[model samples]
Every structure is written in structure tokens, then in C-alpha cells.
Target: MNSMKALSVIFIFFLSLVTFSSGDLIEDVCGTSSDFKVCIDALRADPKRCSTDKKGLVRILLQQCSTKANSIYNEVASLLEQAKEHVLIQCLQICKENYDNAIDDATSAIKYFDANDFLAARTSTVAIASAPDTCEETFNEPPVRISPIKSKDDDFMNFIGLTMRDLIEDVCRTSSDFKVCIDALRADPKSSSADKKGLVHILLQQCLAKAKSIYNEIVSLLEQAKEHVLIQCLQVCKENYDSSIDDAETAIKDFDANDFPGAMSAVSDVVSAPDTCEETFNESVKISPIKSKDDDFMNFINLTASLINQFGN
Candidate 1:
């Protein structure tokens, strides 16, 4: 642990610049990774991300994978010891051997990484990533039985893959549109790299921007709103947007204070602005000039919320 801590500090100094905050560093690193959400989730899940640098991310990921690998190795061993069926025993034998190599490789990989041996670290990590494949295939051979440790294999793979691709594919899968969410995150490099808290920060900024823009537009519309009904509706909308902006600010403060529920409540408040605006127009002319814009902004807010739900996991 002491060695790891020392290595983490060295990683921060050497891999990340002093000018950037942890949030900035996370955005920059995740921005460059093949999987943004995976990287950010992995980093932001650990409170240490706020203090670490790029290589520190690698250290953290490697350590996580290594620990999981050890546990999986033990799990495989336990299964091997308990196997009664000849076929299952054979499969477990193969899995045990695979885990043996995997554990060794993981150990070497961390030592190599901490020592700044990039080539070796890459080699070991690649090995670790592929280590479970043989175990999986062994069970699928001949009569084709399922691997007892299939879930464990997959779990380790996801952790290891966080450095490369997304581990938490389910985050998007459960969403309204997985591809849309993925594209949205990937489209913005900083956003792609953001952890849960960081993502909320970005999403709220968008909400705030949308609110202010819509508010200004509402004010402008008031200038041309000749009909009494239209004028009244516009006034209501302006006030609604004003309330939303305040709530959004409150959400930001609550989020920073570690009050997640409070932040989400504030986020929920943002909905009333758009909903009430649309309803006000519907009650009168049944058509709002700002309906389309409000709808679009609302979609953005929902997407942000969906993403927040995923990252919160």
C-alpha cells in the first residue's frame, strides 16, 4: 500500500500537469480514451481521482483488475476442488491453470507499471485481458457446457476493459436510446471523460444555458406579444424560467455538497419551467412559438438525467 501510494504521487506529478484540476485531467484523459463513460466511471467512482493524474488512472485500474483477478483465481480453485463430474473437473483444471498464469501476470503488470516499464505493463495487461478466454473456451468445447465462472470471467474483463473500452454497457442499455446517449457523451470529449459528479456539472451547465437562452427569448417575445393572452403566457414563462435557473443553481450547490438527493430534486425542479411554459400556451392559444425549443431543451435535460442515473450506479 505504501509503495502504491508513493507510485500514485509520482504518477500525479509526472503524468498530469500542475495547471489542470482533477476534473480537467479526467476530462482530458477520458476525452482521449476509446471509451469515455467507462473511463470516467472508473475514475470518478474513486474519490482519489480528484487528486490523481493520467498514469494514476492506469495504476488505479490495474490495481482493481489485479485484485479482482486474485479473487477470481481463488474462486476457480475452490470450484476445481469441489468438482465431482469428470467433464466439469477437466474444465476446472484448465480454468485453474489459466488463473495461475493470470495472477502471475497481474502481479508482474503492476510492478512493471509502477516501475514505469510501459512496454512490459502493456504486455502484461494484454495478457491479463485475454487470460479468461481459454477458461471460457475450455467449457464450450466438445459437449459444450457453460463455464461455472462465466460471470466472474466477464466481471474481470469489464474491469480490465475500463482502460480500453466501456465496462458498464448496461448503463446505456437501460436508457431510452443507448446509441443516442453514447453519441452524446462521445461527442463532447470533456463530457465523455466526466465522472458522475463531473457529468452532472456539465449537464447542469447545459440546462443553465438552455434556461438562460429560453428566458432571454421569452423576454424578447414579450416585446412583440400584442395579444393579452400571449403577454400573460410570456410573463408566466419568464417567471418559470427564472425559477428553473434558481433551482439549477441550487442543484449545482447541492451536488458539490455531496447531497445527491438534493441535487436531483433541484434537477427535477427544472422540469416545471418547460412543462409550465408549454401548459400556459396550451391553456390559451393552444400553440406556443417556443414549444419546439422547449421540447428540445427538455429532451436534453432528460438525457442528462438518464446519464446521471447510470453514473450514479
Candidate 2:
């Protein structure tokens, strides 16, 4: 035990020597001092000194500086673990300074990106606002000294957009005419439709799409933060849904008040029309039993007989 204790002391001494000699690798890139207040302030004041391209340079600095900063932090932490009372305080101070400096570098990158409003240009306008904190919460780790917000935003939006497109196609397999009519009015960037009847069906489908959008946003928020945010978001969606249903009811009421027969005639036509289901199921054995010509003829005669019997009664 005594020999082991002596060996541990020698090892720590050697480690301290190494840490002290590795004076300032991070400082060389950032500056001569551990305090980055002056360095960060100067960069903001006249950012050209940092690099030629303001946005690109800020990103690069954050990326490169983070690795060096982490090394410094680890060294300081290790030194603190083996320090005497006198050196422990100094080590703690240095650790705090380095950590803050790294965070500031990250903050600078975020500010530069925000100033350019890059999020709007890309599809990540929403994710950029929420991801930094969300990523930290999910990892149960402190926010990284460097965050690739722009890159992450791009990946997230691309994946969601593709998924939404696939969902839309799978759910709505109407005729080309119907699809065209709905696409024309759906504010979708794809195709257009000319059939009036198809537009109504498409509108209802769009309501579902809107509900899904809000649900996704709520889920993403809940994943990142408290359940309260998700609940509030859902409440907003419910209110919006109610308002839309009320508007639709009012529109229908007005139409009926002005022309009840006209409204009924349109509804009757839709009821009698050969629906998409009939077109798609035409050859299936299940439907042929009812739609065959022999069955139709028998049904016609039976209907006439029933009418004659009714008059006699």
C-alpha cells in the first residue's frame, strides 16, 4: 500500500509537469491569454481580422477552436484532481475561463448565422430555433462548445419533407382529374386539377395535413423540453381546428339558405356518381356479384312488381 501510494504521487507529479509545460495551444489560435473577453470583443468589432468571409470564418473558428478548448479543459480538470489547496483554486479559475471562452465561440457562430438569416433561405427556419437546446436535452449532456446548426437543420428538413410527400401520395390515390383539381388548390407545388367535386375532397384532406403538421411540431418540442410545451401547442391546434370547422359550417349554412334545392341537387349528383371505389374495384369478384347484368335485370323487374303491389294495397 505504501509503495502504491508513492507511485501514485510520482505519476501525478509527472502529469502536473506536462500540463504546466503545455502552456497555451488554444491561446495561440485564439490569443495569448486564457480570458477570451477581449479577443471575442475585438472579433465582433472588426471581424475581418478573424477571416475574409465573416460567416464562413466564424463557423471555421468555432469548429477549430472547440477541439483545442476541450483539451485545455480536460488538462485543467486532471490537474485540479491532483492539486494541493493552493493550486486547486487556480486550476478551477482556468477551467471556468476556458469553458466560457468555448461557449462564446459557439455563441458567435450562432449570432453570425442569425444575422444573415440563413435559416429562412433553407427549410430549417424552425429547427434552427429549437435544435441547440433540443440536442443538449436529448443527449443529457452539456451543450457542445461547437454546434453544427446549419448542417443539422438541413438534414432534418430534408427528411421531414420527403416523408410528408410520401404520406400525401399514399393517402390520396384519386383519379388524375381529381388529383389535378386538388393539387391546383392545395397550394402544393406539384400538379393541378379541374374537377370541382375533387376540390372538396382535397380540402378535407388538407385539414388532416394541417393537424399532422401541428402534431409533429408538438412532438418535437416535447422531445426537447417539458410536457407543458406540447400541451399548449396541442391546445392551439385544437382551437384552430374548431375555428376552421365553424367557418366551414357557416359557409354551408349560407349556401343552403340562399339555394337549398341547388345544394341538394349537387349532393344528389355526388351520391349517384360512380365513385373512385367503383372504378378501382370493377373486376373484383366481391363487387361483380352485385353489378352483373343478370342481377341488374332481376332487380329492375322486382322493383316494378313492388310498385304495382303498393298501388293495389
Candidate 3:
């Protein structure tokens, strides 16, 4: 976790929705933000911030907002499935419904923003921004239960207050599974201005995020395992995930240093981490406790490798 966080520190600073003059778009837009330094860092990392116009940047923001809402929706649903308490379940249910609306509103905002309908996009943004409040307030009601998804809620709102990668078309055309390629890019705003090398960079980030998420979950699951088969599967999974994290970070560094083939080779090793993990559970005849996480990571790593395969073709 520390290594992942340390590696991500270089990329974490990004901007949200705002327009500004030509002299310093990142500076001007980020300056308007409530969190100045954080905003500055985000836009600073974007090599295209100065060249990309205001409209393009805002479109990126809206698309990212939509992407994040979908993630939050899925996360809430997962939490809802595990909640045993009546009040907690009820709160999650409310959050689930609200996030569903947020997903639509943020998606709608993208279309409206794209169509030059600023008024409507603003309207949608208003609806998008309300979701966190509604969800957070639901947990604050009498017999209050802490929202299991508070971090997600806060991040969602903060997005409304930071934001997409332009995806699918060209970069995905050569992907083995085109749809999976698109899905892998859903949460990446830098993709809007990224090229082939850049897309690999984004896909590697996606793969790493999924890998890290599943690895953390495995750490927790290991603390509770009683079945021998499950423990054995999880132990193997931990080993796979551990190596995957190292490979992904190495790939990212290679990409940054212009060693494209080296990056590809590293990520090729990465693609097997989830596959091996899943096969362990399958061979042992045990349903993987982290099935969704495994599948999600698999999807990301596959796309990362597939796109890298197409780079020289």
C-alpha cells in the first residue's frame, strides 16, 4: 500500500471543471478551485492542459464525473449486499438509489456539455452534486449508522467540485476485446489527450488500481479464513497480487522513460496475476470471495496487455 501510494503521488494532482484565459489555463482554472494546491498539481501533470481548450477540458471533467458515479454505485451495491443491520441496509439502499440517479445525471451532463447546452449541463451538475449530501444525510437520521461508503461519497462530491479520458475509437480498435478496452479507460481523464503510449500508461494505472484494491481485500479476507482450501487459494492469490504490483509499477516507470517494449513485457507478466488467482479458486472448487475484484482486475490487465500488443502493429 505504501509503495502504491508513493508511486501514485506523482500523478495524483489533477484539476476539475473550470475555464480560464490563455496565459495560464491550469493556474487560472485551478486558482478558482477551493483547494488550490491540489488543483494546481492535477492540471500540472496534464501536458496538454495549455493546448486543450476550455470546452475540451470541461467535457473531460463531466465524463470523469459520470465514470466515478458508476464506480460509487457499484461499490454501494457491494456494501449493501454485506450489510446485516436494518438501519445500515436502509441507508445503503438510499445511497444506492441516489447514486443511480447521480450516474444518470453525470452522464447527462456530459452530453449536455458536449452539445453546447451549458444551462442544462449546469442543471445536471446540480443534481450530480446533491447525491453525496442525500447519501450522507440518510446515515445521519435517527438510529444513525455510519455510512460504509463515506470515502466514496466524499470523493464523488470532490469530483463535482475534479474530472475523463477521451476513449474507445482509435486506441480500442486494435484491442482484442474492444469493449473491454473502452471499459478500462472509463475512469481516466488523461485519455482525452493521450496517444498510444499514453493510453498504455493509463491502462497500466487502471490495472494497478484494480490490483491494489484486490490485494487489500485479500489482506482482509486472510484475517478471517478458516477453510483450508480457501486459505490456500488466498495465499496463492496474495503472492500473485504482490508480484503484480511490482510489475505494474515497473511498467509505469518504463513507460515514463520511453522504453515501450520493456513496459509491455512488464505488463504482460501483470496480466497473469488475476488469471492465476482465479484459476487457483477454480481448481480448488471454491468460489472466490473476491470474484468481482478478480474479474475487474483481469479485465483491466488484459486490456493493458492487448493495447500494448497493438502498439507497433
Off by over 4 Å in 3: 1-168
lDDT of 1 by residue, 1-313 (tens): 2211121122222233334554578767656555566666776777877777677766776676666677778888898788899999888888888888887887887898888886566557556655566788788799788888887665555444433224123344555566655655544434322344554576667778889999999999999889888899999999999999998888778777777777778888898899999999988865798999889877777766665555445
Tens digits of per-residue lDDT, candidate 3, 33-130, equal 44566555555554666677655544544455566678778989999888898889888898889889988887887787777776566557656656
Off by over 4 Å in 1: 1-180, 309-313
- Report lDDT (Cα) of residue 178, candidate 2: 32
State residue 160's C-alpha deviation in candidate 3, in Å.
Answer: 17
- For each candidate in the order shown, give its overall lDDT on alpha carbons: 0.68, 0.34, 0.68
Please give the lDDT score for candidate 1: 0.68
Clash count (model 1, backbone only): 0
- The stretch of ten residues in a row with the least summed lDDT in candidate 1 is 1-10
